[model samples]
Target: MDTNSKIKRLTILITCIILSTISYGQTSIKNINLKAGKYKVGFKHYTINDCTRTYRIHNDFNNQLIERPIPISIWYPSKIENNSSKQLTVLNYLEILKEEEEWNDLPNYFLLDWFPYLWNTPENKAHLSEKVTAFSNSYFLIGNFPVIVYAPSYQASSIENFALFEYLASNGFVIISSPSRGTETRWLEGGSSKDMETQSRDVEVLLKEINKYENIDVDRIALMGFSFGGLSNVITVMKNKNVSAIVSLDGTERYNYAILEKSPFFNLEKFSVPYIHFAQKEIPEEVLNSDKIPAELNYKFQLYDSLKYSEAYSFRFHDLSHSYFSSFGVLFANRDQRQDKSDDKIMVSYKLMSEHTLQFLNAVLKNEKNAKEYIENSPVKNGFSESLFSKKMKQAVTKEFDYKDFNDLALDQGYQNLIPLYKRTIAIHPNLELQEGMLNTLGLRLSFNPKKLEQGVNVFLLALYIYPKSANLYDSLAEGYFYNNDFENAISNYKKSLVLNPENQNAINRLKQLQE
Candidate 1:
């Protein structure tokens, strides 16, 4: 060959090898394939009222309706109608997110210094969202699909769980998620517990709003939450009988358990729903010491132990943290924080979790015969191990604590008469997350009633007993007493509240009027 031709041949061979490597890398992410399901997916958003109550979520003790809107993101099976949406690349989501005002703080979470390295690696960057997303503004599929209403983790946006949500929606499920204002955990300051009610009520309002549209199988609804969202699932199921099942993704009810003096919304004796819990296995050498091990991990063991009910299953995945459960969580966190677990390994674990969640839904919602075994019988893979668990009963059971049962009591005997049940329920379960909210609602609801003024005073007194440190609760009590014409008692409560917090302006203002 001529010298020029020989040089060209060598260059061609090297170019082909580089292209082949890049192709292999692009084809898979981590070690798992996150390709979209058989059906095309559609996306939409709904801004709904917070709940059944006329009052919005952020209202203060005065019951003045402070309007806080809830923005919900929904995904569903879609037809092949073309529009403006192009098949997305992973980089596209990055660009879209950067332009979003709400997502401005997002890039800080993703270690930007490593972005160039990840960008250059075709395997990590190629065809990720391409395997997901759909035509913008596409209509929902004609037939009814089972619904999955999701609650995001602490301060987590609906977009954080986008990959998982898209997977379920494309697989013939209608999945929706809300920002769950007030209870975003970041908002849970001053040791306040009222946000638990706000979260459930927010979820309830979002579902009711979404169900007004077509293609939703309301009967097959399931509540799923990651981390603290798990506790949300627990509390929401108690109030709504329509929810068929619950999935907790390493749910952070453990953290809540650490701070709970007692539970007002939970009852071990009343445990009945079919549920599945995926727990990050306790760290090595921690043993079973409650003090030594993190309270969050220990609480899961507490819940699973005391919370034996029908068709409940628990699995433990070793070498995982609370963060790896979500794909976006992995992508956003500092890569160095992942303990050197490759993206592929993390992806594999996510696949297992998602598949098991699907199996759980099949077993409970669709009556699939072998779905239980598929989950409980799962063997250890990539440091994932299943904890031996037995179904609570041979068959699934109905809800144990019905909202109608409590509502009937509140409506029939008067709100004050319902106190015994709250006290008794908390007596049995100390992790009742919504105790404060429930009591506040009870006290304030009756306080405004002309016939129930004394009842309001009684309920407010009870709330004070439960939350002694809460200046707001004391302020609420004083207002209730003042309205009931019990000026002496009202003055006493105002003084007590001032002792706790001298700068309680509302209480201070009301106390001056009562004295005059």
Candidate 2:
């Protein structure tokens, strides 16, 4: 063959090879279509009748005997038909809102009218009741779904993050959340490991209580948390052998706390259950250090290895803020129309984080094959490079003109065709704002497609540049580097992560093993 012919043949060969490589790397994750519905369990409200208990006050006050009441609301899958319009936990709602406003430094006005879309009435009381009831009514049943025990943040009641509790409850999982004593006031002051241990014991007691009910698979239990709650879940899962898995959503890193004289690293070896740590982009560096985190948890399986069970799967969304991982954030953001999409970063973070959490839970708790496949092969599960985001964004923009016609066609195709159109719409939108529905679609695609990993990483890195002191970003970069076999780079990034978070055991151990 002539030189030009040979060159053409070689070009085609290289193109095919690259395309094949991309195809081999990609994995598909299915969208979890949770139908909206309402269901309630017949819970007999009863307070824990402990007549006298010694309580310690924070103001150097003496221990006093007091009666502590556990007002419980049990929500289980029931055959009762008249439970549709039941009002949400009103007393709990008011108390939680008051506490959240102070903890998050949010204004009272924003908290009063959280979801404007759901509000429509002259009587504010009725509107609030309807809004909450509607939320409670929308339940998604994952037939025989595993149990997830949620530990609340320090000095924060279980009801404080009702949005998250409601969402999880609606998504087919039975969530058991409780407010520990001293958990409703001065959160930061009471964020102690001892408090977390006590909360874990509370979970154990709650689980025993739940056994009295029907249809709960006690063996398949997972522990999860948000913020200080995340730290609590970690300690809980580590201490409790009954817990099959542990999940952390923007949890406090133990690194900063590890340096304290009363650190909670006593039983690191007892923690053998799988852990899924979903970090926000704005986590402080003080929480990412290796020395601060227990050394055992730093192994590749628990740190950088995504394929193994008894592993740690960590991800950091570049634009995700600390408060974005819970439903309370959505209500907070919707309160102000002038606020940009960036303000709802927590909502976006929750959507993505929830999908992964569900997947991880399925893999560990239910032993779902499809979920495991998605976790092993998906870009989100493995590691995406930082270069692919711009490419995907550009591709999305280029296809915008065709979106209108596609939507019109979809309208005639029984709305099923609109799913693709909706996916394209997300790609086409240039606002960089993350909508929950749109994010759910794109995130599923990103998780499954290895070709998109580079793009996802690129987008995340761009986000990191905007928020540099982010421990999550460093952790993500370290994961990407480990996947790419750039162990040195991964180690360096992990070290940087440690500088920001001195207690990240996973990062430290991974670095040590890789160095060895």
Candidate 3:
């Protein structure tokens, strides 16, 4: 052969070798060895169009406004007979992916190539037939289970993290997820602040969607996200009060705090839930320089640093990179050999991530004692080496005893002992004040409801004690008594109101009517 031809053949051989090794040692879901909990896992897929928002299919011949399509994937604890033949396979999840990606007609043969992430390798092909824990069309378990509403990574499928969802469901939790899509279309606007809000809103829709499920314990809820989904979830947690905990899997909130801050609802105080963030290993200097990624990303987490009201736990899994946080990424994503760890190490770290997520959820949502200790303790104590995984936990700085806390105490005792509760709360939280306006509105709302008249009177009484000289409180208290047929007390409060404000015409009229 000529010298030039010999050189060309050598180059081709090297290129083929590099390409072959890029996704070496790909793993199956079974190889992950996630021990299933006592409950059987059930899978359900359904679509709900959000009527409030309009969407467009960019590929349509004539673009038109239509209700935003939200494809939901739910995994919950089930009691169905364990029929292996009926269980969902990896292919089933990717089929859902095909529908969600706006290519509903895309043939199964082209699935791997159509999406850049899923490689068509021998190991990846094997995964398609593997039976996951979840059985499709299975009946949900009888009892109410805690919920975890998941948001997928940027423009990803709802079932991107199916393995984790199945594991959670097997442990008696309900996992709801929708694809991360643009505000108006299937594609995002280059991962902008708008994208974050859109995904956050999608998560909120799931929050409302949870209401339909009779088996869900709405009070016990958590938000889990990967990559950009992580950033979106922070805003979700801020805007929502129902979320009790949040889990981030190598979330972008750490790398892109500015995008998270751009949200109007962004407030550190609102993130007062039990939070756990599992971060990828520090990007090697070579990759950082080559990829133009900022080195500050490895250490600077403004959100984690600013959080003072959450029992925050931050962990670094040394063997995993950002992609491995999701099941699809671990099993199919082409590894960046420059920064990606070996396949064995990645699998181990993923299992670690899954366990930690379970422990954190158990601690905050299920209130499991052992899980709480597992989350609070050091990585060494959790049976992992410091070199492989490291942890940092910050106890929630005692949250302020706000009026809501005081009200909860008052509510528990039927609003009878509010005055004593207020006094007790004041001793602990010196600055705590039951705002006269809040008390007035609350009292009026309750007083108008005949069933809650007594509770309303109690609220007004507490208000009067706080604002002794206020005519409004006296007038409101009189109205409460009037509504309850307590004429003598009504006349007394009307007179008190007149004493505070002689020009109080309502009080004057009320007192005249009572005297007559």
Candidate 4:
């Protein structure tokens, strides 16, 4: 690029900064000029109730399920309330440490216990919660908007990443977040994996409720979790197909925990979607705590490599620690000599984190061609060198389902000629989980195109061949048959499904509908 091009790009960014400042009213927040978006933002809370789960750690024994109140916080585009609306109060570690359990009762044996010593005694953040561009419970903007469900790191508040949430919301996305609840960092007695599993389950319940909102487009949803929260997010999205993308910020480091005892299948097996993980530079082996590196990091590396059929991106920022991923990191910095990095440095990293995240999520969820180009073409951002970046497009070889290639054929020509392709693909890449994701996408696409009902049936039939005993596939095939107006085949497949798995009430109900 020429000097003129460089000058033009800088001018555009500077203009954006100035306009954002003008709209949001210049902030009193020091050392940061974080950019806002096109729309004024609004924030509100949704208190979720009727959650029944009995954890052994809550008491000594697991009993009947009890109601749990999970509070979900939301940020969205709204009519500007006034120029003076301050950003919400920020939550700090000390307050979180006092939430439910006594401070002494929390674990202290870990290496992290020493790190907390570096924090300046938590001060009241009210003075620090300066100007930002958002309203308090303003009327939401009309139209169905894309959604981002965020998960905070262990022991952190949902408000930990408020900067990112508000920014994404300002850019016209619905952002939802919830407290970690049972899995909170207040106590580590509840195993890391167990807490994550609890949070993961909470995410499912939260998304179900978020979908009920009138303005949210259920089809476009993404999951983002910072630090250990990323682990929870990866776990949730692997189970919930409704999530279309994921952004993990310095997320891979949490793989050090073995809550699931190294069994990747439960959390990693079906990772066939658009996922990007931004990480801090790797720690030197000499400086590593143990004599060896954690096994889980290697597992994640293997999984990233195996995400051959998905749009996978991984990058390591030149100089950043794990905490730099969220806004809280900046507030926590420079507390003591032991923590020498200044808040301004972390703020720089956090700003980029917020910016890149919005861009990446925009690329996948909104299908913006230029956003994808920006991600692929511009790997390194100015000042902060993106030390390492890699993107794996699904290899088009056989036995492995090439999602991009197969999706093209399915949409352009139809699923009629796709079975042979899948057969060869499955033969080469015989991962049941990946195959399941492909089939599910095919089923969803088929449902949208009612005229392609028979094609849907054929696709499900191919899946049945791959997973012959899967009751769910039979039911899906039955639905496809019914959609095509083939009542007889529909009933037959539903009966087959019921015979294989008697508990599928959905299949039973569909069967009754056909019979009646």
Top candidate (lDDT): 3
Tell me which residue pairs clash in candidate 1: 25-123, 30-344, 31-344, 227-252, 262-430, 263-430, 263-431, 263-432, 264-432, 265-432
Per-residue CA lDDT of model 4 for 123-193, tens digit only, reads 32332445555567477788788998888766556666677788888898998887665643234333246
lDDT of candidates 1 onward, in order = 0.60, 0.49, 0.85, 0.62
- Measured over all alpha carbons after superposition, the RMSD of each candidate to the real structure, in angstroms, is 16.7, 27.0, 7.3, 13.6
Taking all chains together, the TM-score of candidate 3 against the true structure is 0.89
> In TM-score terms, which candidate is top?
3
lDDT of 3 by residue, 314-365 (tens): 9999998777898987898777778788888888889889988998899899
Number of clashes found in candidate 3? 0
Output candidate 2 Cα RMSD.
Answer: 27.0
Q: For candidate 3, list the clashing residue pairs, or say none.
A: none
TM-score of each: 0.59, 0.50, 0.89, 0.63
Clash pairs (backbone) in predicted model 4: 155-185, 399-424, 399-425, 399-428, 399-429, 400-425, 400-429
| TM-score of model 4 vs. true structure | 0.63
lDDT of 2 by residue, 101-183 (tens): 22334443454455221232232333233334222343333356567777655444555445544445544567766655443
Those runs of model 2 whose alpha carbons end farther than 4 Å from true positions after fitting are 1-46, 49-53, 56-64, 71-74, 83-92, 95-145, 183-190, 254-265, 282-309, 333-341, 380-516
